[model samples]
Target: MTEVLETTSGSSPRTRMNKRILTLAATGIGAAGIAFVVAGAIVFGDFGIAPDFSARLAAPSWAHWFGTDQFGHDMFARTVHGLNVSLWVGLIAATLSAFIALGLSVFATTCGRWADMLVSFLVDATMGLPHLVLLILISFALGGGTHAVIVAVATTHWPRLTRVLRAEILQLRHADFIVVSRRLGKSWWYIGRHHFLPHLLPQLLVGLVLLFPHAILHEAGLTFIGFGLEPTKPAIGVLLADSMRYLTAGNWWLGLYPGLSLLLLVLCFDAIGNGLRLLQDPRQAHR
Candidate 1:
């Protein structure tokens, strides 16, 4: 009877296989993403800034996988180094954005009604504006560098996460456990540190992970438009911008490989985030 029950349960063989596939897919993608970033770091440290003028505008070959740019720099090396820069910028910006969202959400939920209203108003106002326009304006105003790009992306990307977290915290604030803690003379800080923070961890992590791709893309966009890292910097946006001039001369490899690499990296992050979201759901356990 036990054997029969096991065979008939929701965790069937097919379901288990599917779950395994999903888990493997997620793990593989996440690992690949990390490995790509690590490879970029290694390449940046070892081969960065080693341009050869003799090989200028060379086509892709075994010796130069991604071909050579106008400066005769190895596109493979530059792309990898550029990837490292993009990853660093993305990570820092996403982390800052998440913290900003967390702080605003906490304040809105714990302070007072007026605080909540003010936060809501601010979030709405920020969201109402054109995101790219605001980012460009902020980056331009800040003098168009790495620090400026990071600040612009961080400040502009927090509103959506802030809204979600604020709603979650508002719901949790009136929970019976929270009320009990309040009645027991626990201060808001104490309750928040012990109760609210633990519950917010998953949401915070998800939001941070999801923000990575956006941050990377925006940083690249700003750089491409001459408002991000300087042209001397080996960044993805800079690479793309430089590739534009050679494209009309039929040197497509200059842009093709780097662009594809950026797209692949973004997709990997998206996959990792989606996988995490799915894993967090209990209903997915049997599937």
Candidate 2:
């Protein structure tokens, strides 16, 4: 799909209005879907481990919409539970990562040249390693649970955002008002509170929104490989992994539905992030 109306968004006023409506609609849908997922998880709670052998390997039906897994667990319930776990972990991880970037950017730009150099070195060192490898190593080292996944993602995902925030903060730091404020003997806390926060908030917000997809995807990957969530948890990765064994036996619904759900969830996050970015851009915001 087209992104952000980067050029002339639409041919005419009517077209621009239509595009804006479309963007709003997509964003609303994404928000609603996320809310629904959270509500589903709350309603269903944990997926029951009590086996229903009679319904084992059942296909989709009105009673069990996404069908049953090998153990006769409701796939739909499990998928929702899994997604909920992912959502929580991703939100926490993305939030911490965004703030980490914000803090480092502040430190880098305001502390001194040596601080800036140190931050730059750290960013390069972190980004130089393979991303997935770094995630795995960190998760495994932390003993691989929800917290581990959060920490792994939070640590690995901040470098690019840090660079963005650092550049933005540095520019703002040298702006005429900032220079004047410094000359006027404004305290660091005062300038930061008054000047830095306003300028950095939007960039931080956008970075936080964009980080969700990566955090969620990496969480699933780690869990799928048996290094993230515990085996007993009803995580999407766990569902997908269990389905792999039975796919060849003609029980396709086990994997298909959950995989599609994950894809849809990720797409929703991407849509929201893109939508926010577009709205923040002056050209697209008016369109």
Candidate 3:
């Protein structure tokens, strides 16, 4: 029994150490991939729009890596530029959604029971509708621009994170510290600023990170369906939409490159979120 206990204790630390290292590595890789895309976007933004009609429909080569589309634009340049634009849109939408979640969570938890019920109903009603359909309708109503995509995604994505934060806030509401603060005559704002925000920070951060991939994918989907970003811009959806024409003509790179890049971007953002979540959880073994 003594030997077993010693071995178990020794191995536990080793396992946790291994987990920490792997989590950090995953986060680092995700950050590096994002940075590379951001840098590529800066370098290739002009190339994406500069049509070289002379090289139209050229196959992938040393001169035009990733090939030239029928419009004579470089696939590699457009892929990078589109991804960066998608990144910015996702970042803006996700940030707005996070703020919305935080605000609603606070209102539901701090307000009377009726307020909580009302917020819950709203969340459910919003969530019950098809997410894509809601996005399309909202975007169309706003006349379909980059701003419209941001607004649509921002509004649609909040309910989920709001639900998560609401649960957290509810639990926090009953905590001894919060109760004590109220007894001492602290205002709700004071208690929240001093107590609730600290505990909620981790969940908020993780939710925001996880929200990125969803926002990006939805924006791309909206654009692909003719209602997100403008077709003239170098959006991944625009690239993919244009690629469809050449895909059946034996030009596979047009579709393959942008789609694959978007997939990789989403995967990397997801990895970052998951890594942050695992690292923050003390019970790493269970995960």
Best by lDDT: 3
Residue pairs whose backbone atoms clash in candidate 3: none
TM-score (C-alpha, index-matched) for candidate 3: 0.93
Provide backbone clash counts, one per model: 0, 0, 0
lDDT of 3 at 187: 88
Error of 1 at 55 (Å): 0.9
Question: What is the C-alpha lDDT profile of model 2 across 67-110, one tens digit per residue?
Answer: 99888898888888888889999999999999999888888877
lDDT of 1 by residue, 71-161 (tens): 7888888888888889899999999999999999998888888988999999999999999999999999999899999999999999999
Query: Which parts of model 3 have CA positions greater than 4 angstroms off?
Result: 1-12, 285-287
Candidate order by TM-score, highest to lowest? 3, 2, 1
For each candidate, the alpha-carbon lDDT, in order, equals: 0.88, 0.88, 0.90
Over the stretch 105-214, how does candidate 3's per-residue lDDT look in tens digits?
Answer: 88888777887898899999999999999999999999999999999999999998999988988888899988999999998878777888888898999999999999
Minimal lDDT window, size 10, model 3: 278-287
Query: lDDT ranking from best to worst?
Result: 3, 1, 2
The per-prediction CA RMSD against the true structure, in angstroms, equals 3.1, 3.8, 2.2
Question: Which candidate, 1 or 2, would have the higher TM-score against the true structure?
Answer: 2
> How far does residue 140 in candidate 2 sit from its true spot (Å)?
1.0
Provide the TM-score for each candidate, comma-separated. 0.91, 0.92, 0.93
